[model samples]
Target: MNFSQLQCFVALAETGSFTEAAYAVDLTQSAVSHALAALESELGVTLLERNRKGVVAISNAGQKIIPHVRALLASEAAIEQEARAARGLNVGKLRLGSIESIVSPALLAGVLTSFRTAYPDIEVVLFEGAMHEVGEWIEQSIIDIGFVVLPARGVESTLITTDEMNVLVPYGHRLYDRAAVTLDELYEEGFIMEKTQCMFRLMKRFGFELNKDKPSIRYQASDSATILAMVREGLGITLVPRTMLPKKLEGVVALPLDPPQPLKIGLAVKAQQTALRGTTLFVQTALSWAHEHALLQTVSS
Candidate 1:
C-alpha cells in the first residue's frame, strides 16, 4: 500500500478518533477514510473497528500489523534523512520523549537551544510523559531518542546526569525542619506518592525495597506541581527529585534523604545500529551542553 494509506492507518490507530487523526496527518476526514478504505480493500483484511460513538479500536489483525507499520514509517523517515545527508544537507527530524521529574528544566532548554543552533534545519518534537511511557515509546520506535532514568533496562542508554531524590512537606510539620529524612522514616508513614516507576526503581537501586512492607499511600499524583500542592495542603508528604522543584518553594520544606539516594538520568534509543545520524548528534550535543553548563553529575559519556 502507499505511504498515504499507511500513514492514515497509523494516525487512526494512535488517535483513536477520525477527526483527530485527520488533524494529526493534515488530511480531511473524508480523505483519511478513503485512504483507509482503499488500504483495507487491498489488504483483504479489516484493520480498524469503530464503535457507535466513533472511537476506533484495533482489530486483531491491526494489533499484529501495527508494529510493522510504525517500523515502516520510521524506515521511510530514515531513508529521507539519508537522502538529504548524501546531498550535504543539514535537515532531519528528531523526536524526543521524557518525564517531567528528572529532566533539568533550565538545562533542557539550553540543550534544545544548542541542538537547534548546531542543526538549524532539524525539526525537534518533544513528547513528555511518565517514565514508563517514555521507555515504551523508545522501544516501540515512536521516538528517535528519549530521556530515561538509569540504571534502566531494555534500551541503549548514555548517561547524562545523576540527581537525588528529595522530600517535601508543608510548613509547621514536625519533620518540615529536619536536616534530612531517611527513606525508612518517610515510608514508615508513606505520604502522597509520585506516580513514576523510576522512583521505586531508584529506591531499589539504593538497596531499599517497597515490596516487603508496602508503604501506606494515601494519594497518588503524576504531576510534580500537583504533588507539591497536595503536600502544601498537608494532605500528606511526598518525595520528588530536587531538579523537579519549582523556582519558588513558598509553603513547603524541601529536604534531602539523610542517606542521599542518587537517580541517574540518561538518553536512550532502541539501539545504536538502527539510530539515525541526527539522533547520534543530538545525543552528543546534549552531553556536551551538560558538560559546558556544569550540569553533569555522576554519569560520564
Candidate 2:
C-alpha cells in the first residue's frame, strides 16, 4: 500500500474515530475514509468495523498488522531523515513534551536557543502536561521526546538532573523554623497536594500507605504554584520538588525532609524507536547547557 494509505490506517487505528484520524493527519474525513477503503480493498480484508453509532473497531487482522505498519512507517521516516542529512539540509520537525513544573521559562528558552543555533532550519513543537501525561505521550508516539521524572515505565531514559523534595509550611506554622521535618510530623497537618501521579509515587516510595492512613487532604490542585499559594494562605502543608520553588520565600518556608526524597528528572523516548538525528542533537545540547550552567546538578540514571 502507498504511504498515504498506511498513514491513514495508522491514524484511524490509533484514534479509533474517522473525524479524529482526519484531524490528526490534516485531511478531510472523506479523504481519510477513502484511503482506508482503498487499503482494505487492495488487501481483500476488512480492517475496520463500521457502525451507525459512530464506533470504530480494528478487526483481528488489522490488530495483527499494526506493529508491522508502525515499523514500516518508522523506517520510511528514517530514510527521509538520512536523505536530508546527506544533502546537508538541516530540516526536520521535533515534537517535545515536558511537565509544567520542570519547564520554567528560563530553562525552556535556553533549550530553544541552543537547538535553534545548531539547526536553524529545524522546527520544534512543545507540549506541556503532568509527568504521567508526558510519559503517555512518549509511549503513544505523540511526541518524539519528553522530560519526565525517574522510574518511568515503558520507555528508555537519559538522566538530566536531580532535585530534592521539600516540606512546605506556612510562615507562622509550628514546624516552619524546624531544621527538618519528618513525614509523620507533616501528616498531622492539613495537606494541600497536586493531583499528580508523581506525588502518589513519592508517597509510595516513602512507605506511606495512602489507603491505610490517608493524609488530611484539604485541597487537591493540578499546579504547583496554586498549591504553594494555598499553603501560604494557611490552607495546609504540602510536599514539592525543591526546584519548583523560587529562591526567595515570602510567606512560606521550605524545609528539608528528615529523610531526603530525591527527584530524578530525565529525558524519555519511546522504547522501540532509536533516537532520530534531530532528537539526539537536541538532547545533547540540553544536557550540555544544563551542565555548563550548573542547573540542578546533573545525574546518571
Best by lDDT: 1
TM-score for each of the candidates? 0.89, 0.80
- For residues 1-301, could you state the per-residue lDDT of candidate 1 as single tens digits? 9999999999999889999999988999999999999999999999999999989998999888988888888888878888888899868778888786678787578889999999999999889887888999988888889999886789999998777888888999889879998877766655787676556656667776776556667788777678788889988887678877887998999999978887788999988877777888888998898787663443443
Clashes of each: 0, 0
Compose the digit string of candidate 2's lDDT tens values, residues 61-102.
998877677667766765677689899876777879988765
Q: What is the lDDT of residue 113 in candidate 1?
A: 96
Clashing pairs in 1: none
Model 2 alpha-carbon miss at residue 120, Å? 2.9
lDDT of each: 0.84, 0.79
Q: Any residue pairs clashing in model 2, and if so which?
A: none
What would you estimate as the lDDT of candidate 2? 0.79
TM-score of 1: 0.89
